[model samples]
Target: MNFRLFSQLSSYHADIKRLIKIALPILLAQIAQNSMGLVDTIMAGRVSATDMAAISVGASIWLPLVLFGHGLLLALPPTVSYLNGSGQQHRIAHQIRQGIWIALASCIPLGILIYYSDFALRFMQMEPHMAHIAQDYLHAMLWGLPAYLLLMNFRCLNDGIAKTKPAMVITFLGLMLNIPLNYIFIYGKLGIPAFGAVGCGIATAIVNWSMCLMMIGYSYFNRQERKLQVFSQIIEKPNAATLKKLLQLGLPIAIALCCEVALFAITALLLSPLGANIVASHQIALNTSSLIFMFPMSIGMATTILVGQALGAGAPEKAKKLSYAALLLGLTLTVVTAFITIFYRYQIAAIFVTDEIVIGMAATLLFLAAIYQFSDTVQVVVGGVLRGYKDTKVILYITLFSYWVIGIPLGYVLARTDLLMPSIGAQGFWLAFVVSLTFAAVLLFYRMRKTQSLSDDVLMARLEKLK
Candidate 1:
């Protein structure tokens, strides 16, 4: 019995090692991408509160729109993963073509929507100067929409093929470019006029195009990708069925993403009444937490690809093992990060802004943020696994229950203080966030288990048929 138990432990250890091999590079790449945004916010914060607010407001206007496109484009990775798993390389290319079409179709409406974001900010009660700065940023950034969507499609395709290293390399180069570009544009160095916050927008646009082109160039020149029939058929006619499938798969992700983003946007709007200091503090905490989240988020993305490919290859057991392995790895890493944040929360918050109130509030929120990290890691990894299984609808419903039904109500009661506790303010919201994520983690894991069980049954039945 001891030998058997040792064998089981060894198997589990091997699975985790495999997961790490697949997930670590993806995590690093995600961190690099996230750091770009963090650097932008930090640089903007250094200029002035007004500059920080401009970025916050600009993000409020831009992120939702960008995420909407991202959500729609998310359909590509899973589809490619599924096809690649089935050895359908030609179909992968066709899906890529369809994905490009979908991205283009969505960009027109999205561009128009984002273009008018400045006018929308006026209605949101932003100050004239702030609104102007935000408008300039939004308009400048809008130019990158096509490029951004294209890059996402390519990244997803590459990830589907289990090739994360190229994406990582491209993203790192983009980050390297972003700092100099931001410095040059924001400060008007190198004989350029200082564009301030607007410069961030321009720099972002350039990076988007550069990354997209670089990915395209790399895919074209690389022998591995070139050997795939899909690469050869880049200019093939679009298939309606393929488009429909992409849309079906992508729309829920888009809606789910939009809902979450809308929640943050609404929170920003609500906090606006509390004064700029409160909002600024909230943004600081939000930004910091978001950066930390990239660790789990990257693992989650890796989980989706790995699990999807496992399922596509008719290995439900392998998929299940991968999911658990990823979950364990994510939890371990997140716990370490949480400890770091807990011990140095104040010092970390100091990096963002100079305001004492902002720093104090952010520090308080960071503690709650630490508590949520475990739940966040679990939910994200499980969610990725579920996406791999094409069980996104269930996850979407779970998110609704956790975020809206439970989290928002609890936050309202705690933050506004009508019933349970006095106004704990933003910290109250963070506590609610922790609760919601915990519930989500439980539901997602349960669902993934059910799905895995079903998959196993199907596989057994298929094997019986073969006999």
Candidate 2:
């Protein structure tokens, strides 16, 4: 064996270990967050399908609404990591302060949207009882929106600085709180009247606030935070420039994310008119894919911090190595997941429902999902690195071109028309998804290769101009 090649291989293995070290906690945190959703759905279903529909409807209503705000905050981790790596940790306090302001400002529009959630349901022409429940549930959940947004900033601060374990612990804590509170409120533990699905919303709100308050306590007293003075100006007046910068950086990220989410959502809706079994199959496959996707997403998140820190420390070459290794890890895990999805698709579908037709369709969709896993992994991991690089607007542009301009149209044609090929239903759409994700991966990574080699000075200048 060549000595240099052996040494390089050993170094590569070490990078993978370091990548997993950071990502494992983030993966757990993301899973815990996902579990919160599952808990709500299962608990609500125990009440009635009507109750389940209410909460599901409420979730669908709010999910897109919150994306822009969340996206805005997504920029925080990398930006903070930049300061952290540069030894300018004192500046993070101001970032946190401005993030709070951004959070509060974001809440107002979201609060009003949730308050008028009735209009959304009514517009959909939903069943009256379900609509009322959904509206009320949304209203109840609104109480916690402030808490969720505030917590997100604090949480991102931790993520930015490579202190990821607290986020994992806090989310697990939220999960623990959710189940019991859900039981009590859902079943009327004391004098409180049972609000059914509304009770679930109430419980989630409580958990949201609890998590936020706990994070606050954690941040204030956490020795590192004190050293960095993250909470030093907890009540600083919101700076207009800072707030605008957050929005400018965040909105594109949000839009790009929403584009992908909307693609899936619209595909489901489009698939709905096909048949119940088709829709059910698509959903099962989608849900499973979503769960598996957390792995790469978590890896990407950790990559962002690692890359941002390297860049901030003025080590562009280190940033490049981190990004490359993280992408390799993402691709490797995706390949493993794809094989698992292929081998166990039928069994996975069996876990969801007992209907034979639904099972068959779901298994097939899972196969298609497996096929696209490679492309999906690339897009997500690359997107993460771009976020860390503070080159987020390009993400929005790339997603729009790939998803809307290319993927959606082709999927529509293949699903409904013989313009290019025979109509193939949901499977056809999934094929288009593969193409679009491939396109995004190719284009986005091309951009990365070009930008990744720039010295920290040049990249920092570009990042500063993003404001």
Candidate number achieving the greatest lDDT relative to the actual structure: 2
Q: Poorest 10 consecutive residues of model 2 by lDDT?
A: 458-467
Q: Which segments of model 2 are wrong by more than 4 Å?
A: 455-457, 464-467
Instruction: Indicate the TM-score of model 1.
Output: 0.91
TM-score list, all predictions: 0.91, 0.97
Model 2 alpha-carbon miss at residue 276, Å:
0.6
lDDT of 2 by residue, 1-467 (tens): 69998987687788788889889999999999889989998988998999998887888878887776788899898889988998888888888888988888889988998898887688889899999989989988999999999999999899889999998999999999999999888878878888899999999999999999999889889988888786655489878877777777788987876666778878988888899888899899999999999999998899889888877887778787888888889988988999999999999999999999999989998998998889888888888888778888888999999999999999999987899888989888888988998999999999888788676678778866643
Which TM-score value belongs to model 2? 0.97
lDDT of 1 at 414: 83
User: For residues 1-467, what per-residue lDDT tens digits would candidate 1 score against the true structure?
Assistant: 99999987787788777667667778778888877887787777776667777887888767777888888877776667766776667667777777888888889988998898866887878688878888888888989989989998888888888888888899999999999999998878999998888888899999999999999888788887787754665466777877776776788888888888887777766666667877777877787788888888888888888777776677778888888888888988987999999999999989988888889988898888889999989998898888787667787799989999998888878877759866877777788899999999999889988777775777545322311
